[model samples]
Target: MAKDQTTRICCIGAGYVGTCTSAVLAYKNPSVRITVVDTSEAKIGAWRSRSFPISEPCLQEILKQVVERLAFSTDIEAAINAADLIFICVDTPTVTKGTGEGFALDTSAVVACVAKIVEVSTSDKIIVPCGTADQLRKLITQKNTKGLNFEVLSNPEFLAEGTAIHDLLHPDRVIIGAENTPKGSNAAARLVSLYQAWIPSDRIKTTNTWSSELGKLAANAMLAQRISSINSLTAICESVGADIQDISQIVGLDHRIGPHMLQASIGFGGSCFEKDIRCLVYLAESLGFRHIARYWMADLEMNDFQKASQTERITSLLGPLASSKLTIAVLGFSFKAGTTDVRSTPVLTIVRDLVGRGHKVKIFDPKAKKEDIQETLCKANLGRERAIVSLNAMQACDGAHVIAIATAWDEFRTRPGLRRMDWKSIADGMQQPRLMFDGCNVVDAKYLEGLGMKVLELGRKQAML
Candidate 1:
């Protein structure tokens, strides 16, 4: 395979990574044919009809442009047989049963895909496994009945939930890892050429197989640690009556610290941070590094503690939850802005506690689907009786004693060309002694206080009581 040549690419698993990657490749390299295969017919159907399963900015627009070159289907075997290169983008979620129950990654889906490829593939192909590189190589080598040569490569994706399209189009850096053999170098160069179509040559990095795999895990761990560190300081700030935002500004000013993930909020969430941290913890523990495991494990513990502490503070302010049947309005349901991913979101913890204590909770998000929110809550064993989904923020805030800003969306803040939320109208409709818990610290607390709403902001002293 050479650059500028039309190569058939098959991506196994039409989830977030697979779909976004296939679309970008198809858009950048129009001559190359790419097909995304998944077992879920509904997901494939949704893509075919332009009804995307997940919400991401600029994703649909790019998908529309590459519709002629990119295809979604349920026929995995046929796509595998016809492809010269295959990408294993299947989900490797943390195992929830048997061995490695909570922390270790479960790569069963990837294992199954390997079995199918080994049975159906008839030609030499470059296999890019996104997870468990060593296990994937072992599985393919053991199951190969025919004399077909397979070159295994580790090409893990580094995509953030909301900015996936931009990350794909102009990634900061791309890591491709393969064996240090002649064939491995050749395969790495071929994939590099595909990315070079749009990405600058300097942005792509090639390394050994283990570094690529570990790099993905370590990158998420580092980001999650920053979030936990800032949150841990928020507790001290509350005790000392010092503002966390001020501290963040001063600390982030340091050239070494920078100002990326230093914002103090309720906690970090989404599919990556907590899951990847746990995987790292498990990896350390498995290697007999007890101290190392404990250090990484604290990041996850601090995240949970931050969420629980915020819920406790809100509930304590309401007196006894059993005595007061207060109506609370939750402003956001998704993990963060620009995406509708509810996995491991902190809002779930707060709302679950409120509803379980007999308080009514009304939730709203700009882009999160009502069904997705309901499903997430239901999976957590949270009943829907006291937890309701509102059509708009106004409906949720009406007759509510407290308004909780869970997700920090740009619309919630005052931005140019965007109409700010009508807090005066919302405050007027809310019940007396109205309170606003700015979990994300997006709005101006002083401004909200002027509207006669008591503001309780995270990482700040409680003085507006």
Candidate 2:
């Protein structure tokens, strides 16, 4: 199967999925030369320089051992020409406009990648489809391009951004989807061999193409549904004086339901969960299954509601929001901690709303790069005069009339880091009736209340507050 003297591997994208996945492959198989090529020279340079292009743990350590085997470049055609196996790890962002608009997947990059490969290829290469594509269109590309034969195998990545390295090294399961034909099966076997370097044989699953294709979307959809379901219960908890954390603990005890993605927060935000769920909804609607589409779309709708409502909810808590000339402190800017990725970060919606209402928002995130946050703020046309990033945790919360915990960074839980004073100091340094809004429901509200502060937390027993 992949019995070439030296297996050549090329990954077509150097973004989140590409960089992490290709590094793991290179680390596992030292003999196999892996080339990671991206359109962005800056991204390629970042990868080559062995810096954190994306926030992933253990990346530097792994790259140390396999950096020589792995190469990053902007040359796509040359990579395609020399590769026996190519992983199309390009991005498939959710379409934001046009016919499908908000829900459908924008696979323009994947389509364009296929066309380029067809134009350059001289031999049949094992094309492992890690993201998205239709087989019929692939067949058309095959038919049109002379001397271009691509063995398209579906091998989607299931690694989370924060824990990508660990997930790659010790994956719970590995799925390899291929056509039912002999060539497809053989291609799948080659991939299985590559992964078998580290992953247990039992963990690798072989399936038909369609099952593999939908499996990625379905898995993400199910995760989003779980998160939305918990968020939905949060509203009830808030009104009825119940604690979502407590509810989560009680419900999580059920072995069947499991205890993943059950935490109630502002909402789930990342590259995958929301967008992938939208894709599932779009697919259902395209097939005229309107009922099924609505059923699936509900999860995404709940997530959006949770994010959008944060600003208004906080405004309602503080009467005459703008008239009050509120000084707000926001801790955690990234969608989740341990990563600099801020794409679709729920905090964006809240920050925008607050700035629009004339509230001054001071932000602090130990991990989220200030430049990235600034870029996002620039896109939203949020002037630095209103929303600005503070140097440290304490600085952001110093003179704030209200403190909002947006991201669940480890540092947010403690005090001295934020002169968010000791219960004793809080009263003296902070304004009267110091209001704290726990946007993520991550902080200890009861403890904050003990400091003579008025704490409003999400999905918690706050009716009396």
Candidate 3:
């Protein structure tokens, strides 16, 4: 591939991963003609617009710089035919039913994309499995392409939602998993060259196909496991009156453990962590490693328990749910701060549990749009209009008996105005003896108690009257 020549790169999916990856690639390598293809026209349209669909700070400016180089279309065949390197970035969600329902990845779309690639591409082009490699290998083997020649490479992306652009721009490391074959190694090298524009060559790591695939899953599992471990300790901290934050900070200061993803909150939530962990567990079980599977499964079970424990705390503080028709204010809905993604938000789990017991919920998040929250709630088979989406933090708190801070958005923590906003204004706006449940441990329980409001903070004992 010529350095100055326009290297055509086509990404199969236009979702979060596909869009962000394509944008960054275009931004980094202006010479590369990056075309992002998706089945959804709305998604493509959003990408074409100025106010891009996703709200990541500095993403719009970056997109603007490379808008000319980047193209969005629903025409996959045209994009694939003209592309020198094709990235299969479609969703490989967990299978719901069948033999490998819970654990195995559903690769129907990946297969379809591969078939399309085989049909269209004339030259021996590199086909990179941007998705997980293990699942793609199964599909490749099943198809049995004895005649056609193609280079398959595994180049997994490790970008979080909120900080995807930052991660992509300043990646810690770029993993390229290729076969020992010349063609496979060459393809991996080609992909590495693309990232060499921004990322250091030394940061680029190479490994076998299986190792790369399992590495992605293992990385996420371990990140989530750390969170679950901290949360599990939060329970003991609450019982023993120990400060979870202080404990986390002190433990994180050690060079071995390090301080990252240690901040205690409701639980871990995102598209990757839980799904990947479950996939890892399933893979282990299939390989006759039952003990390994059980150990991994325990991490997820602990996560669920942590979310459920919050609901239990709410009921314990607020008294019986049968007689009290309490109005609950949810501070945040998105899985995490800085992004509007609610893939597997612990807030949903908490809301479902509360609603199941007949409590009304009112939600508010600065970044999360109304439609996104509504769609998430609808898909979860929860009420749509039952929860009112507020414009500001104070508005959401108004007219609510209890305030549950689920997502630890920056505004939830350091905003002086949020703290100063009279709980009396909230109380007068609602029923008497207002309750506040700090699910994220962002609020100061002492301050709230001084305001004469019943405050229950996670990883701490309830405030005494």
Candidate 4:
């Protein structure tokens, strides 16, 4: 393709990564025509309508600006037929069964996408996996029968859910990994040109595909390890009556131990952290690095332990759930605030344990859809009536004996805004011996206690009232 010609880009799998990347790419490079295609008509339909399937801050505004150059469709072949470059943005979820079950990412979807591209593509195409392994080149080489040239490149995305748009617009760095050959370098440079539209050339790093793939896994693994390490310290803090926040502040001051992902909370929850760490674990174990695999595997064990300990703490305080028959209000469900994704939310573990013990649990989240919450519960075999979804925090807290702040949302705190939760009003409506559990530590513990409510914040010790 000539530099003068408008680049035609096709992104397979119009899920979060594909949609966001395509929208931002089109917004930055107006000359490029990008079509995001998915097999799911519902997802494509949602993209076309006012009600988008996924939610991210500033995404809608950016999508609105690039509407002229960006398009969404269900026709994979047609998009591939027209595209000069195709990005495989399909989901590579952790495999549940068979070989490598519970640890390895199932790349079957990516493999199928390669076969489809090989079958439909007529011209030389640059194939980039937004997040994939290094085996793509071998797969394409074995499958391509039309004598068409396919250049496989690895360009993994590293955008956090809550601040995805900002991360994309002002990324710390952009990595493009390709083969060391001339064709591979040219393909990498072509991809770099698209990013150079907005990103500074110095911020973009070019490397071999293997390192790029391993780098993503290593990064996520280290992050999860840090979170687990902090959470583990929070447990010791609670035992010794030392505030984890203060401990974190002191430790973070050290230049060697910077402060990021060090804030104490219920536990880390999302799609990436656990999945990526497990992938690293599987890779380590497969190569006979048993000790290394166990080290990474311990992080996951610690996360689970943290969640279970929190549930046990709450249950112990509330007494036997069968005899109590208390109404427990749970605030926040979307793992973390600013996004509506609940793949591996840690709070659900607490909710399920409470409900199983016969407690009435009412839940509310600012951004999570009620239906999605119901679906997640139903999949876990917890009936809709088992855990009622409240319309708002007030509704969830009404007539409740205890309130638990699960997700760290800005509205949950006493900020100077209309959205700030009125704790006094909520406390007035609660049953006697009112107790509040702060999982994310987003509340003013002193103020809440003054309202005759017992506050139990994680990583902090308080005398029994």
Collision pairs in model 3? none
**TM-score list, all predictions:** 0.96, 0.93, 0.94, 0.97
Candidate 2 residues 1-465, lDDT tens each?
234333898999988888788889999888899999989998888777766577788888887888788899899999998888988888788887798898888877787777777778877788875555464345546555475556788888888878999989898889888878887777788889899999889999999877888998999889888888898988788778888899998899899998888888888888889888888888899999999999998888898898887776677666654467778888888998778888878898888888888889898888888998888898999999999988887778777888888987766674445434344453345664478888776566667777778888888655333
As a TM-score, model 1 comes out at 0.96
Runs in model 3 deviating more than 4 A are 1-6, 132-148, 320-322, 414-424, 463-465
User: Model 1: residues >4 Å from true position, as ranges?
Assistant: 1-6, 319-322, 414-419
**CA error at residue 297 for candidate 4, angstroms:** 0.3
Each candidate's clash count: 0, 1, 0, 0
- Per-residue CA lDDT of model 4 for 1-465, tens digit only, reads 674343999999988888889989999998999999999998899899958898898999999999999999999999999998899998899999998999999999999998899989888888987445467778887888889889899998898998988989999999889999998888888999999999999999999998989988998888888888889987788878999999888888889999988888888888999999999999999999999999999999999999888877776666544267779999999988888998888888889988987888999998999998888888888877769999999999989988989998988985446347778899999996689999888887888888889898889886654
CA shift of 228, model 1, Å = 0.6
Q: Which ranges of candidate 4 are over 4 A from the true structure?
A: 3-6, 130-133, 319-323, 415-419
lDDT of 4: 0.88
TM-score of 2: 0.93
Better of 2 and 4 by TM-score: 4
Q: Report the poorest 10 consecutive residues by lDDT, candidate 1.
A: 411-420
